[model samples]
Target: MVSAVITAAGLNRRMREDLLSKGMTIEHKLIMDLKGKPVIIRTIENVLESGVKNCVVVLGHYSEEINSVLKDFPDERVKIIYNHDLDCELSETLLNGVKNIEYGLCLCVAADQPTVTYNTMAKLIENAINYENPENIVSILARKETGFLESAEGLGMPFVCHSKLLLNYLPEHKDNLNPILREMISNDVVFYGTPAINELELVNINRYNDYLYIKNKF
Candidate 1:
């Protein structure tokens, strides 16, 4: 069974500022409407549908508001965790979620990816489970600028690998997750990229413009 760590904890300064300028009063981007559902909820649903056994959602910055919206979420497979440090970096927030994983294979998801399809997630999970080597990481590369499957920074999020692999390195890691994965690659942890159903499936919401773009696309 694959467990998932959904990182929703971050200071939404850019999105907040962008919404405020338009006189909108959203507490966090995760709770924003994506089609007919909240962005985070849609993300969680897709993860569950993809065959993940369980998932931990790590929340920060508008934790209360995000929690309130997700309080009655119907799936028992989803768990919510809190990172009290509002200014914590992305790696720190992911660390909190990674610690709660109960399965050997862990899937790291960004909560802002509301449009990510279950097919894309399922393909990655299938690859991870069927992989010959336990040490290799399976990931999806969505960013075009990065260009290569293996870059200096290594593969980014929406990746699946052993929880021990992340727990072994993440505690002492800092900043974005890609660098740590890069370090792991240098230490013999090979990463394989799973093709995404669509590049738009991995687009994350950072600002109001992103939200608008996705909403339109959806």
Candidate 2:
């Protein structure tokens, strides 16, 4: 059985600022509308449809809002963890999720990536499960510059890795884990890259402009 973790624990400072200007103190970007449903809801729904046996969502910045939105998912299939340190970097959020993963291969995906399809997730899980070398890390590569996609932007360096390897290497550099992960890839860490499904899948909403762009696209 493959496990998946969705990291939703960032301050989303820019989004919060945008909301504050409109007289809102609590605006959860993850729960913001995308198309018709909430962005994070769409993300979690895709994970459930992808055949993953277990799913863990790590919440931080807007925990109450996010948790309230996800209250309908069954506790048995979806679990939530709160990260009090919202200021901590991505590495810390990843580490928190890794500690809860119970499967051999855990996929750490970002909740902001609402465009990620179930088929894309299935492909990643299949590669991780069937890969001959346990040390190999399976990842996805984006093709174009999607406005909201973070990994596909120039020099953004998008890729995914096995939870075991990520957990092992993340602690060495608490501030940033990508550099260390890339180093591992250079040292013969078998990596399987999939063609970008669409530039939209890589979009990560970081600012008000990004949110507007995605809203307009939808």
Candidate 3:
């Protein structure tokens, strides 16, 4: 079974400042409303609907508030882990979730990426399970720009990865996750990219404007 890990630990400094300055009381990007539901809630809902058997949600900065919302999920397989350091790097949560995942592969999904649909997730999981090579990293290429949904192959989230392989590289790793991922790619850990995806599915919420654009269009 391919499990899922939802990263929602970031303080979202940029989005927080922008919202506060604009006189909006939004606490975090994940808490912002998307089609009348919290972004994280929408993300979790879609993931669960995709039939992911196990899920781990990692929360930091606003753990209390976020935990309250997660209580709504009825799935017994969902696990919640708290990251003590609010200023900690993303790798911390990745490691924390890895310890709890009992599966071979993990879906490293982001809480702010609410547009990732059940269909996309299901396809990626199926691909990971049936992949010929155990060393290959499975992923979905989503929108990185306003381009064709058919041709755009921008590297993206909800990435299907070898849990143990990544966990092995966690020790001595520092700062952000990109460097380690790049290092793995350089070491020939090829990413098994899934089929083309809709540009909307890759709209990551980093800034207030990003939230606005997705809320308006999608």
TM-score of each predicted structure versus truth: 0.91, 0.83, 0.88
Clash pairs for candidate 1: none
Residue-pair clashes per prediction, in order, are: 0, 4, 0
Per-residue C-alpha lDDT of model 2 across residues 1-218, encoded as one tens digit per residue: 67788888887788888877877665678888888888888888888777778888999877887888888875578899987677788878877887888746776678887777788777766766767765466454435442223242232223445666866777777665556656665666766666557666667777666777777875
- C-alpha lDDT of all candidate models, in order: 0.81, 0.71, 0.76
Prediction 3 TM-score vs. true: 0.88
Residues 1-218, model 3: lDDT tens digits: 77888888887889979988999887777877789888998999888887677889998988887777788778788899987667777888778887889858788888998888888888777766776775465454443422212221335467777787768776658567767666666666656555546767867899988998889887
List runs of model 2 lying over 4 Å from the truth: 19-26, 143-160
Model 2, residue pairs in steric clash: 148-203, 148-204, 149-202, 149-203
Worst-scoring 10-residue span by lDDT in model 1: 145-154
User: Model 2 misses residue 109 by how many Å?
Assistant: 0.8
- lDDT rank order: 1, 3, 2
Residue range 115-172, candidate 1, lDDT tens digits: 7788888877877777787546645544543322555353577878888888888889
Better of 1 and 2 by lDDT: 1
